[model samples]
Target: MDEAGLSRRGLLGLAIGAGAAGLAVGAGAGTAAGVAVGRAREREDAESAYAFFGAHQAGITTPVQDHLHFAAFDMMARTTRDDLVSLLQDWSYAASRMTQGLEVSATGAVDGSPEAPPDDTGEALGLPASGLTITFGFGPTLFETVEGEDRYAIAALRPRALERLPAFLGDDLDPAASGGDLCIQVCADDPQVAVHAIRNLSRIAFGRARIRWSQLGFGRTSRTTAAQSTPRNLFGYKDGTANILANDAASLDEHVWVAASDEPAWLAGGTYLVARKVAMLIETWDRVRLSEQDAIIGRSKGEGAPLSGGTEYTEPDFATTDANGAPAIDPNSHVRLAHPEHNGGIRILRRGYNYVDGNNELGRLAAGLFFLSFQRTPESFIRLQRSLSTDLMAEYIRHVGSGVWAIPPGARDGSFVGAGLFA
Candidate 1:
């Protein structure tokens, strides 16, 4: 049958049949059993060109400032769906074994890319990002199972975020229309480490499945700058000055948490949104003076606080009038343009990382953010960027990369990638 015409139900049926046969080997048993099977497969089908053994060990590491971010996706032949599912089941089992005993935070979801009635279970899977650093992986149901000869996609994100988890996991954001199947982020002190992590993950992913496409990202600096350090956008003087903060649990309940009234029972424990952008341009940015730069950004150079006068994270009254009764914060200022609320209100949960690259021909360094955000909707995030693109900072920064992903509800055992897509 044509790959596109094959349905997920058909693929699942195939996987169930194959899974029963592989039971003599117990392919779907558990992580421990899965690892043993995975090792056997690696040895039997071992191709020297694809070093599956070494690739497996490259998945874990201690906290480092610079770490690699890698992603890969593939299409499965209808006939091979069962074998593929068995293979992935084993791979996940083996991988978890290798990284055993480490404080790893993970979430798995099926493809619920298309909208469905909310699952009404009150049980909450309190996967909070407070104080604990963690990375997330997203596997669509179709991709997870050995199904039809259909194209299945998987997206994994590393680098855990305590402050940014709400936005990254929130459901209001849609990623299918945005063109990305997987997303991964990690924090490494060194750039090389980040690249190494990404490359290794790609190897494992490609080694097991067929990879259609991939990409990587690096950050400009390891630390957040003093001036542009709002919770959402960077400091370019007035950047993200008008952001909202879930100051109290009540507010957090209102903005960050998904309403129990709107989602599925399984989805009850989930937050959904995946906001991502690829920002570039720094060479031209460095030449501007501190004073001029501050004026353009609408804040002091040393601190990211508002230009209307206040400390970092403090509120700025945008409505205040100047001597001539004009606006105290210039309407065109970066912050003013991005957020005019002035109380340091209107916040977003930012979970982003940086990337770097070199052009051998030009002999120059290319770097910027692998920007990701999770908000309730596209409206607030869109408004902020729209302000930036038309304002003064636009002259220095250009959005070279962009995508949006929908982070669906997590999954139970045996059900593979994006079960939610059809759920």
Candidate 2:
């Protein structure tokens, strides 16, 4: 293999083994080396991540779909303020550099077991050991950037601003769902390195920018969580149910991977979509009685199972008839409305997160979803949103925010897009 490929393979090997020595020391050292070599691989992997952001300058493009949500409030201390600002600058610089020459690859796990591997492609692969996910917020800096660029460029943070739930909901925040104003979700592959990279980036940003607060998230995969499934939001429903599957190579090509088109030769192998929505009113939703809510969502709120009753992965029997001979799932039901049988079915992939807004005038009742989905075209997503907009859930949910973005494909070492596109 070429030097760049060789280095990536070596790094993957080290990363797969970094957990054995524990994440702190070995992963940290590896991350430092990765950063050192990152500059050289800029045109390959890092740059692609950056280009993904550059192309989709208007939306949130977290490295991973399953972000560990965290939210926090600003501290009153001057020292805290100074520290935050410095951290923001560091974060911006490191992330910008990391994305400069991004490359990605999939490797067999260390044990060589038949178990499936996590999808570590695109920006998700760049995450450090400790970082589970990252989320940017809407602050003065973010707003300024958005207004200046006519797009949302700010990234999210984690660990949340407050440990205790805010007073808005009248009860303590759900520990798992509580998030930071800004969050950096670490990678399961190397949590320690991810954590250090995030911290370093935060420090850089703080030193140079006027950031207020940020947080961190550290957690294992669903295989390790108490539920033995992916973490659920405050509503007790599983999130990221429609993520691109790992084992199906053909499906990956059809759904997740987009081939280059003629429009933007520079954007060959790039994909684009928009994902934005307001948080749901969970507290009020909770009061509505379980059956009613289930009907509204067309799934078990606790397990995210289809209303007809099956595991998350099982397809709902939309054609099954009830005792009365009518369709078991009503035609106007949330699920039915959102997922009709015809027109190729509800095809968009949803990779969403939850958010809590304390600034709302309605006294905050466990806000709704930070709705996000991915698809080849906006039309299908638009159809789903339109259905939701007119559905029964519309009474409680609202679309307060939105953004569009593109996800570009990976590149090999030293081979930039324009070099081939404009050559």
Candidate 3:
């Protein structure tokens, strides 16, 4: 089976042939090594848990987890503002308990009567907390109705940056998977734990809210902490190599955390989240030549070094040239275009994941990167994506889903999330 079981090339072909069906490929034999190393690190993290009530949301600055279950929900018709507030209170209480590896309620998982349904689902009964984090967000449409009417009397409280993202170039966004009035991001080292969190939260929202759409993802494509080795995407590329680290307090404050002076009082410590479901055309990408792939990404495939030269962390010499005198890094390469140097130093905290959803009707693999990022404002991502529209890599991917949410500051003890807005 060669050193990599199926060779890199062979795996790519198989991924496309089998419709990408949740296949995880490695660079030759290195994949097994990487998996072994990753699991060891995850084991340590699984044993470590974070506080649910804090200054900022846990998942934003918290160390990235191995699994994600993100869901967006819409308030039910005739739902009152008080109903929403109560739901958030319930959610916050449950979240706090779950993070500590406890049952949803004090009754315990199996302590309830035999005829009654348990408050907490038993799927994760024996599991550790697994470093789970649950973050809540309010969508643009959450502040107002489809007709632009104020629903909760908090229309004026909406941050100007919370508006729906303007349509950008090359966008083929799907309405079914797009906007939502609210979003919940559940992350954990264990897939079952993450899923369990979402399942219980959805159950609590039964009458007042309904899930609009949801996504399940594994093998996080980005690392929030610097100690992690950069993870790879389905396209066999190192993703988020230059991503902002959680330890960079200066960058986080300037680029990620919302300053009190930036907007409305309630949103002072909050940030904005932008999500896009970027579908990678594995069939086409697998057919491309290695040299072209490297040129398109502006990085060496094996080492992930900038094409301009040096190691992976080496600053790209965008000005330098090869013997022929042409620009060493392609102008439209993913790196050159998205680099902070080219974007006024604007940076976003990325926490994306690789996703494979079986096959499409055409018999091709339906797989892609579930793009997730947080910034001080929505403009950061909009500006960056606008510039990236000229990228040569656009041809190999399609943006099928999109959403923008206003992430509120974390809830303090004795209060629910978004409590300030209601005040």
Candidate 4:
């Protein structure tokens, strides 16, 4: 433990306890030599990697990695169940090896016969595992389409919670990017490591499936555990200062993990993943006055404290009024509307990332938060988003891309991913 009576990993959480907590800049590790040594140990640890076999997938509760490569794919027309199963089996084998920093195949890279193409892409050949985790999910369409066609003959297996997301206010969804038959979320501390995982997985998918769309992101916007510091969004405010921590077993069981009782037993220990590509109007926001910006977010830009309160973590005095009789924390502020107190004590585990994908036609930076959240049911996200419809931050952002997928329970050592679906 540190001098503060908190473990080295608890610094960020301590800040949250302080209220008005967001992120602590430069909080962990010390000195160049110390950082170097720490990183070396981390590299060794990363090489061993998180086990791909578990009761639940790793990335959902794992500490949010620094980089992300999220992809959604659609099975090719006429793709058979056998073809899909084969693809899943191959992917499972490859993922198990790659997570341990091994090449995807024994004939990996240059080891494959010269007469044949290399098995692994080889970009990550010399890299450590870098804490890479790849999680896969199935979309509603994967079970049955909106037209009521059971394309995959697995419609009966679909969870009642896996239906299509209802159109929400201010959604400018792009159909090409909004839905997918399958989704893969690859996250890692190393950008190359994350990308490499997706690249090879796409290769394995080959004829069975094709990429519908993908998003690249960096700088995680939330911490999944007390071990991590809260990160900032492109808006420069601390994002998810009071987010659900991985160590909060009670919260995980209640809000994030799917129970056998939730139905469709194949997803018992799994969860639902909702992805939203929220494009922030950065230029407009930058031009706004600082005080106005703080008002919009309901937190001080500098301290991240509730406008109504003492510290960032201070329970917002929602009933407090100003001298003129206006509510202290604006009723429309992002934080006020999204807070669990106002939303029936509902909360979602956020694991979003900041992204910049060049400039738009008007030359404004095409950047925003790639909002990702895992919950026991899609209703959780829907409820939160519906409450945010009146949020002050809404005008400054647009939801352009979106998806919802039912992540299956993790595969055991001898089984392939999603093997239960087939069974």
Candidate 5:
């Protein structure tokens, strides 16, 4: 948060230019130097190598990228506290370089001696960063495993709000795709870039940790900035039409970021992340009547306007009724149930994506919404989810995988993410 609006952790969408003096990149961080040079290579690219050109935006609120590769990891059994710390340090260093459009290290991919293995995976060699952002999170299991083993000895430092999400009404959660000790969310415009990030980071994790479960997503279902239009979900309805925009500082502070006055002093400025893998019954939903579909969601299929009347951005007038005097929006409609007006003014910043994992044995597309949301406290999500238990739309979807994590604040130059927990 410097005067030029460049904070290493905050500006994932924009690389700081050559004039950023006193940058604390480590030895051989030609990575940072290369980023500055790469942007200046062309005047037009220099103008907009990443989103927003030169704005002070954090990764969570950065304009939503087109693809996502999210992976959750479990620390290896018997690994000590030092192993965890070193793993994070290595990850932070690698993430910092990769986001700047460089390889995992200064002598990465192919620059090394032929006698040795290259430092990078090499698939993304010719690609730009693609506006990449790698965000890390620590799950409740990271603090203490199910067997009560506190391998990292940092369990005491875990935030009170960082716990597993309670099972919702329609949850059919699969253990294989559920919990993790740590998670990394990689987003970029190119699907390969997103895949490359997870591949390289997983290679870096080698033995200290391993991916417990992973998901690949495309066609983002939400937008984080006003410049971007709302996207549609697999249900063919506009999603995230009322998302918390990056410019909404008031809502961000009140509903997304953790405050200094909150408990677990180490996590100030950080936020809570909730991820749910919602599987849709596409065939069943398609067979339903069109008007019935609109009624279930409480929004117009095309314009995404509230059924109660007005455009996408217009606030719904839930009290409005039809010619017969029935409620314009069904009490069981999704929009009404999840709206802040119904949930004590609660809202979560969504950064979800539509996912299709090929076809299943029955020939139905194995697809769903990989839902990701950030909130100041887990309760914001919990309350809204509780209210959605009666949603009519719930009949066509199932929650199959779920997790919650404590997102640490942005790291400073020369510091690894979550450095405060160790302190």
Candidate 6:
């Protein structure tokens, strides 16, 4: 431990409170040789990097990455308020470096002492940035536990809308995975890169916080930009056909980003994230007839166009009629139920993924859609979810796990995530 009683790694975390690359900003790394070495290391790994410090976090509005490692954490019992602050500081510093394609510390994996453990886990050595982004959030429990204990004594600062999500219809929710004190959403083009980020961040949390539940997701289920083609979910249907795009600033302001006028001023620039682990009964759904499936989803399986429509992007004609004079789009179809038109123009930005977690004892695949959506207020998601209670697709799926977290605004150059809460 250091003079301040901080461990070796913890001190390194504090030292880089500013940018890790700022090591040479003032003294130029002590010598020209040292400066060249630092630059060389940066150039080797800084490919496809995203800025970690921003007005809003990177992972949310940034083009969705191909892989995700979403982990929920609970603060360890009896930890002090200072412990929480320091942990966030350490996490922020480490995250800033990792997002820039640097190791968790200046002296990384191999450079540490032979007798002691390395600062970094070493799995990501020599790897490019891979467009990595790490987003952190504060779950409702972080402020006040279910039993009403304000462990950290910041309960008053908790936003009024940051309470636990209410139970919805058709929920088979697992208590073990439903709630957490904190959450981190890590995403990258390379699956290893995504996992590496969460693993390292968890290590940094150490005694202060422990992961409550985590999910590994592959094959992005939603597209965030026009450049990305619509991806299929485990149900084999093109999903997120009309999702809020990253470039729609007007829509983002209206539906996704929380406005300054909102309550709990600390969360003004941030948004709420709602996650649902919707398990698709793959074996049972496979036996479904094609025409019936089309009617269920209200879209053609091949083209993904609305049954009442022109093309994939054509607006759905909810009022259109069939030859027999019935609505072309089924009244209870997934598309119609989830559409913004039917829900008082409410919309959310989705960044979901498909996952297959091996088979169950009955020889059935344990696979599902790890649904994620960002909304300006928790009510936006709550209202939409309630509207989908009557959706026909509910027959083949079960919501096995769920959570809601208030994502704090991104850190400043020398600040930590959630620092505003303490301020």
CA lDDT, every prediction? 0.40, 0.42, 0.86, 0.86, 0.85, 0.88
lDDT of 5: 0.85
How far off is residue 299 in model 2, in Å? 2.1
Q: How many residue pairs of model 2 clash at the backbone? A: 78
Give the lDDT of residue 59 in candidate 3. Answer: 94
Backbone clashes under 3 angstroms, per model: 75, 78, 1, 6, 0, 0
Model 3 worst lDDT window (10 residues): 1-10
lDDT of 5 by residue, 1-423 (tens): 122222222233344433243255454354466455444433322122342111222458888988899999999988998999999899988888888778999889999988998999898776667778888899999998888878888988889888888878999999999989999988887678789989999999998999999999999999999899999999999999999998999999999988899978878878888999999999999999989999999999999999999899999999999999999989999999999998899989999999998988999988999999999999999999999999999999999999999988887778888888999
Encode model 3's per-residue lDDT on 37-74: one tens digit a residue. 44454456447788899899899988888889999999
Write down the worst ten-residue block by lDDT for model 1: 122-131
- Backbone clashes in model 5, listed as residue pairs: none
Pairwise lDDT winner, candidates 2 and 4: 4
Task: Give the lowest summed-lDDT range of ten residues in model 6.
Answer: 1-10
Error of 2 at 28 (Å): 31
Q: Which of 1 and 2 is the better model by lDDT? A: 2
Return the TM-score for each candidate structure: 0.54, 0.51, 0.90, 0.90, 0.88, 0.89
384 in model 6: Cα distance from truth in Å? Answer: 1.0
Once model 5 is optimally superposed onto the true structure by TM-score, how far is the C-alpha of residue 185 displaced, in angstroms?
0.5
Instruction: Point to the candidate with the largest lDDT.
Output: 6
| Per-residue accuracy of model 4 over 148-229 as CA lDDT, tens digit each | 8777678899989998899899899999878899999999877888899999999999999999999999999999888787
Model 1 Cα lDDT, one tens digit per residue, 237-289:
32333333323345434444444464333223234344344444566667788
lDDT of 6 by residue, 1-423 (tens): 112221122333443433344554654333444334444544533556999998899899888888899999999998999999999999999999998878999888989899988999988876678789999999999999989999998999998998888889889999897889999999987777789889999998999999999999998988999999999998889998999999999999999888899878888789999999999999989999999999999999999999998999999999999999999999999999989899999999999999888998999999999999999988998998899899999999999999999999888999999888999
The TM-score of predicted model 1 comes to 0.54
In candidate 5, stretches whose alpha carbon ends up further than 4 angstroms from where it belongs are 1-58
